[model samples]
Target chain A: MAELRKDYILDQYVIIAQERAKRPSQFSRSPPTPSSDKDCPLCPHNEHMIPGVLEQVGDGRGGWLMRAIPNKFAAVGQEGSAALSTHDPLFVHGLALGEHEVIIDTPHHDMEFEDLSVEHIERLLQFYAHRARVVESKPHVRYTALFKNRGEEAGASISHSHAQIIGLSVFPPAVARLFDRAYDYALRNESCPFCDVIRREKHSKRLIFINKTFVCIAPFASRFPFEAWILPLRHVPAMDKLRKEEFSDFAHMLRKVLRRLGTLGVPPYNLVFYNDERQGMFHFHVQVLPRLAKWAGFEHEVSVPINPVPPESASSFYREG
Target chain B: MAELRKDYILDQYVIIAQERAKRPSQFSRSPPTPSSDKDCPLCPHNEHMIPGVLEQVGDGRGGWLMRAIPNKFAAVGQEGSAALSTHDPLFVHGLALGEHEVIIDTPHHDMEFEDLSVEHIERLLQFYAHRARVVESKPHVRYTALFKNRGEEAGASISHSHAQIIGLSVFPPAVARLFDRAYDYALRNESCPFCDVIRREKHSKRLIFINKTFVCIAPFASRFPFEAWILPLRHVPAMDKLRKEEFSDFAHMLRKVLRRLGTLGVPPYNLVFYNDERQGMFHFHVQVLPRLAKWAGFEHEVSVPINPVPPESASSFYREG
Candidate 1:
């Protein structure tokens, strides 16, 4: 082989991984769909079985506020669940190990974030804020990540109008990176990188949307095609931190970003919240990935993506809107 | 809105971002293509631009081997090269940031990783090892990430067979996480967690591939759908630390892994390397990913993925070979 090896930061040397973590942190495997046309628990008639369904605007019955319930197939083990092994970090031999929940935002089954009204979105934001606070307080929960998958391309299997939250004692390897950086950044920069990002997007150009309390824009360096960021113009760390008055603007900006993507003709989408608000190195930013393009080796290996449609272009489109 | 603020790690909240930095990185603010075309750098270009394309057999010409080069359009900026910037970090106003370099493998232009030969795959491995050493030697380089993107859906602009190496002064936020865990794991266990993983995978029934020098399998706790790990049966810590005799066996194992994938069906894929061979957190390993899926927020936001297909099933499919 080239008698070659990789160089580590500590000046140590070892054989380069001919690939990335040949381990399982990759997120792109899909199971085959069952032929049976079973009723999806989150679907129509099964509504009552869920925690509760809310209607705000147009739920066919009325506008749906949002639905909160115990996720049927939660990744995290549920209350009284007993199939998992012990939660030992030293010995990671256990069930997937954590809590998984589904938050059905709308009952229509076909409606997406882009289709939600401003009022609906505002109510959804309220739910997100409330749930985040509640989830984070749960005992044994070290990290709470809330997210959504929009189309089949984006890995959405249920195809329901909803978001999900996960509470875990152990932070996955991915989140650990952010925590490390945020700690370091805070030590060095004396502030959060994301907070700084919010400021720059506010006073500067590239402003996609600016409501009373939120600003949306295409990031300076988007790693994907037509990627965007929705930040609280006021610089709140977590999605749960928005004020009651600010929730409307934050939700408004989120919808604005999604609506703009609809106009952009992107396919499925995924949203990730880097819960590390940044003691300094961390940026409390929401990476809104429009499924406009696929990610292959270069991206997975290097942790950087070659976004063809630069973020600025998307920002400009938002400016027009 | 719920008077409930989401709490993230690091005490640094959103308030600081409002005052300091707020500018989105930077972009050309242009949209070049909204459609796909066949003429892409990522496409197989056997005789067109590639002169000495490596091959697996057929007098080293027919079966395509691995190839690499400087990316025509890199995402991260290059040092001393003017990248879009108007700020400072450690006295430098703008970093020579942005990713660079591109590695093309497979010459069929129409062929993907599944179509390449085993030795051809080995040559690709040889290339990665060499590049890691080369990039690490560069001055001002803080981190070098090696990754691949297979299909257009995977964020690849070019259709040619290729991988890339992006050198960064600021180690990407994702990678830093491994180092932290390694440190903590080492401190707690008095050894490396990867070492623990190696020992555990070996002892457990979860093990997949085991040669005289390497072990490949689905991790006991995989966070993604088909995430797989390729590790040396033994641990030397960093990539450059690999001994002389182990190269060929390592190469053979890597080749075998890909060769078996062809049996799984032609799927888009990516090969990512953590270069975690640092004293602080270097754990030499390769991540082989069949670009078969997408990150639907759960893996990103929740640190968990609903991996419906267990590793045992995936292993059984490829293990026979």
Candidate 2:
């Protein structure tokens, strides 16, 4: 029998249909074609291919270990007026005014995210925090999104290990909804909903990993087959607020989950960081969504995903040798 | 420069970033592997492979033109209890008790949806309407989703030309949101928002095809590159409410838009029909979404799509010889 599960905080729901489930091995695909260093823009010698560098993390080797640069094909930029205009009650338009930047996670062209050491991953997290703060401080910026897309299927045009930061002039509707839900939950229950989720899931079958600072769990309403959420045990509202110890734990937990995911042919996935600086009640987290299935008409039409694998099963897979 | 556009009725928004746009010709992919009739279950002589036929449309040749059967690997079934259970505030769940069926669109193995004649397409639409009515009449079914996935990338596991009808026990969150927005809009303006959309887009530059009964247009806030919507001229809330002439015009319009999409190497796409039996003010329509680009980290992070091809450009491409 199929079960419908609701998100902990949001009104979102997903159908967990175990009867239609397939083994993790059945979801693997041929590896993405590797990119060579000869023309890879993010490679150490090819840094000139990218535009202006916004930030860089220096290594002891008198060179940068990572670099942040403006996206050559930015979806949103600072060149336009950010004013909203209404041509009619039915037609609304505005400039997508803000910034888009790419953070090259490593100088090596062949290094995958999961292969990075915990210290290296921690530095990358710090870089993401720094960039988020910088982008959020911009005039008219309302929200900043940080995410990493691995593999071609996951929408990475470039195969280099990297992440993106986008500053938006307006709060994205979905992100705004999350904040609204959190605020309402806090007002009603006098506590953060995500904090409650961490407490409830810490010992549940869906729990994947836990550390002193962070806990990873397969959400009850998993949208994808092996989707995992890494949340801080403490009530941290934004990436910039993360203490050094928290970052280390987050890095370790993330790497453990990603390494386990890699055992399944390193399937393409997206790592999305959610935070809201304006909403103090918001509990920031990172969602690792494996692109194991294509979202067809049903998902687009109804916005209710039918996840074949139960999160409990996925947790077991992650915990397996 | 990138511009943000809002959906006419919903709070949804999309970024039209033409600066990163690709030409329609550039979006083509290799054709999908054709399925042979010998092993294709939906082929004319392979009816025995499917368990039971729920409905069939006669072809006047002592055979059927199309058929609807229960999905063998159904996501939901009628066996389970439909009662909701709350383990805690953080974990709410219920049995997904409903129906899943597949409507094989044609008896021929090689015919693509665009290759079907307008009359044949009309019969297919009529069959869809019949199945929808039957499914929606089931007890506890709150929503019926009708959609077709044309290729593997669009989530079609089989190579046959077929559409799926899922009768869900709960109103999908996204579909429910659409109804809520429409109801709110009607209350504020005393007019159906979709009806207003038809009036406004009939002469807009985004208009693709218009007839007396139906009109097709590239929506202003198209999430996909070549997204098109087909709406009735009248405020018809459900499929059963569509008049004969409206069905004819809709078939013509849908065939035309799909044929145009087919010219672009028949890139994988989804055709979704939106209707509500309970919401009288709901003006139903069909959305044709071309899966030309992959939704990566940015999209998953904020739920805001960055469409490379503007609707106006897509409209011009559809209108071209």
- Per-model TM against the reference: 0.70, 0.98
Residue range A1-321, candidate 2, lDDT tens digits: 889998887888899998999888787677766768899888888768888898898998799988899999999978768888875768888999898999999988899998999999999999998898899889878899999999877898898899999999988899888889888888899989999888889989999999899999999999999999999999999988999999999999999999999888878999999877775568889999999988999999998898998999999999882
Q: What DockQ does each prediction reach against the true complex?
A: 0.19, 0.88
lDDT of 1 at A238: 70
How would you encode candidate 1's per-residue C-alpha lDDT over A252-289 as one tens digit per residue?
77777777666544357888765542232344557787
Model 2 ranges off by over 4 Å: none
The worst-scoring run of ten residues by lDDT in candidate 2 chain A lies at A27-36
Superposed Cα deviation of residue A35, candidate 1 (Å): 16
lDDT of 1 by residue, B1-321 (tens): 000111111111010111111121111123223333255544443246433332222336554345555654444445464332324331122333534566666545666554566556555666776776677667656778877765555556566566777766555444565566567667877877777777877766557688788888776544333457788766665555666546666667766777666444434556777675344356688877765545677654543444444455556545764
Docking class of 1: incorrect
Clashing pairs in 2: none
lDDT of 2 at B13: 82
The DockQ-derived docking category for candidate 2 is high
Per residue, candidate 2 scores C-alpha lDDT tens digits across B127-219 of 898899899999878899999998888899887899999998988888888899989999999999888888888889999999999989999
Highest DockQ against the true fold, candidate: 2
